[model samples]
Target: MDSLRHHPIRFHVTHWSDDPFSRGAYSSLLPGGTPEHRRSLGEVLDGKLVLAGEACNPVAPAMTHGAWNDGLRAARIAIEAGARRVLVIGAGFAGLAAARHLREAGIECVVLEARDRLGGRVHSIALGPVWVDEGAAWLQQFNDNPLAIHARQLGLPLRETDFGQPLAAAADGTLPDIDAAWEALRAGIDRSLPLADGVARYLESRDEAVRRATRFALDANLILEACLPLESLSVDALDEEGVGAGDRFLPQGYSQLVAHLAEGLDIRLNRPATAIDWSGDQVRVADESADFCICTVPIGVLRDIHFNPPLPPAQQNALDHLGMGQLEKVVLQFDERWWPVSPSGYLRWYDTPASFGEWLDLTDAVGTPTVAGLIAADALERVFAGRSDEEIALVACEALQAWADALRRL
Candidate 1:
């Protein structure tokens, strides 16, 4: 980890979080990424270079493991073509995976990350007795996932989550029966999944009834997801993309796993790739170095960086059309354990994003009376767009208080 220094020192490291080179960690599509932009980005810029990042993965985007897989996949293509001096831009999972693959294949590679440490959004902060994940935390489906396999092979500990049953409460002095609500919600999701999948296939085929049928299935899935409302998302979008319904919690945190995956690699911390000079045969990176470079920077970073020739009008337009899913998780701590013990978790409706979380019990799992998390998206701009953590917490407390009062009455 080095301070911001262009004045060449013993170890001058600078993170992209602050550096102008890379604006952020991973690329988040901001309602501007158009289909054409994605197509153009995937085109390989005249066949010499390839793009790799979480955004590139359609199924599991924005996850550490997916980015690593993308990097490895890209590297395999590069190596097959006999790339000698390969340069990996970004030191997170993507860069680390690319470096590992290249090194294992006997190819010379160097990873450059615009951060002090490797793990991008997979950050871990010290909580109480153990370091809990402040960022990505979860291992969903250990059966076929590569990360789970690696974790098992390395003998790392795994923790199973208690997602079997969750609590339910209302804001208006009424609490719903937990067992019944969960059963209904679970059944709803099971019935809606196949319908949603069929809708997607229908939409892809351009059926005349696609519009209405897609809406029906999507609306149903939204109820299952316990979103603010079913109408917030577009039917087409819902059919095209499904939510991460099968999520599992990881005790060690995704960042720890990233660190483990990043050991023994040539990562240049804090060096952001400001301007990519891709005008020549050898892709010139960072406005100077001429060599084949792998751009693993997130899409959000691209929104700010200046592409040497300026991204094409089509690409720029596509960037403008693409949108990022709204997803945020907040953890809260309560003074007293007011939540009921039976399948403890709550889902409530709120006017703001901060109020989305009903209640969750972390007493047994995390060993704290913390309320755990409030997961929501889309409503973010309206709820927490400009609010402070204290303000958000106050809103959460108020919501929880309302829920508690309702429970007591019941």
Candidate 2:
């Protein structure tokens, strides 16, 4: 907290579990990522069952907008098929979008969510006077993003923040120039010559000085932004899933977009569809049977679901190949702001590859003395595995202290 000049009073750690409803945070592609898997995932089974989620989206899979688009597509397919009653499972962004569009088209649809509340991954909690998003927080593409469009329409003010700026430097104070090295990396990737397996492998081929200098930033981007480990992320897929120029946060909370999308839709919470009997003419979910059904659950959760006739071998294989990304956030509320106030945010460590390496300055964003520490991939798994909230917080504080010490030395 010394780097930020803030003394934290309380800390809240949110660890999203790989469970019945949401197995992980989002979807990630493996090496040799193919669009065929996504296409197979989105295929309408027997014109009675349709899969709708970010995972089912071929163009923008694992994105909030992609999920919304998939929902729209699924709803349109059911409507065009003259389906009167549609069962939309999981009231996440995709399910909510499908329900909303289905309602607009005057098609009867019921949204069944396992959780008691809506906004699957887009969760927000109040920390004193300000609200902090514990789940999906930022809208990446701003003007062009579908979520941003809905936020603007709902009159939610967006706090635009440039994440490119760094608040703290490396302890050695010999940070390498990333722009030139990044260009070289991109050029190497463009050649499509058998580059190494992952980002870490590709970086290994670079000069020692260049690798050391770019290590911190590059690792941070992979884990924090991509929500995957460098070892698991494919070099080719990295370029394919490019980063957004700027990010916008909903001060009111990202759930507002969910609320807007869910307006007038029949959303039934606390109803987890355990079994689906889609073998006959009518698609059955729980006790209710509809002309068609849209399963918008995450791929991790889908693996466990019981299908009457079972999913096709190709679809099952696709689910097995696609991996879920893990991410955990630790939100700390301080008595006062002790850190430098930056319009964007703070990137703490230069060498740490863990999630806590980057801390978002929520002090200005939420009008409170609070910051969120992120952890993802293998680091998150190792640090948080079998650890309590208190233990996690202690580790996070120690990391912050270490970062503060480094800043002081510089």
User: RMSD in angstroms, candidate 1?
Assistant: 10.2
Worst 10 residues of 1 by lDDT: 4-13
lDDT of 1 by residue, 40-75 (tens): 554354444666766665545556666777787778
Listing every candidate in turn, what is its Cα RMSD in Å to the true structure after a full C-alpha superposition?
10.2, 2.7
TM-score of each: 0.71, 0.91
Candidate 1 structure, TM-score to reference? 0.71
RMSD of 2: 2.7
Candidate 1 Cα errors over 4 Å, as ranges:
1-40, 162-165, 172-236, 240-246, 287-290, 311-318, 334-336, 342-354, 358-361, 385-387, 404-410
**Which lDDT tens digits does candidate 2 get at residues 105-205?**
88899999999889888888887788888787888666667877777777887877676676665655655665565655666543343323434556667
Model 2 spans > 4 angstroms off: 1-7, 189-205, 240-243, 346-348
lDDT scores in order: 0.53, 0.75
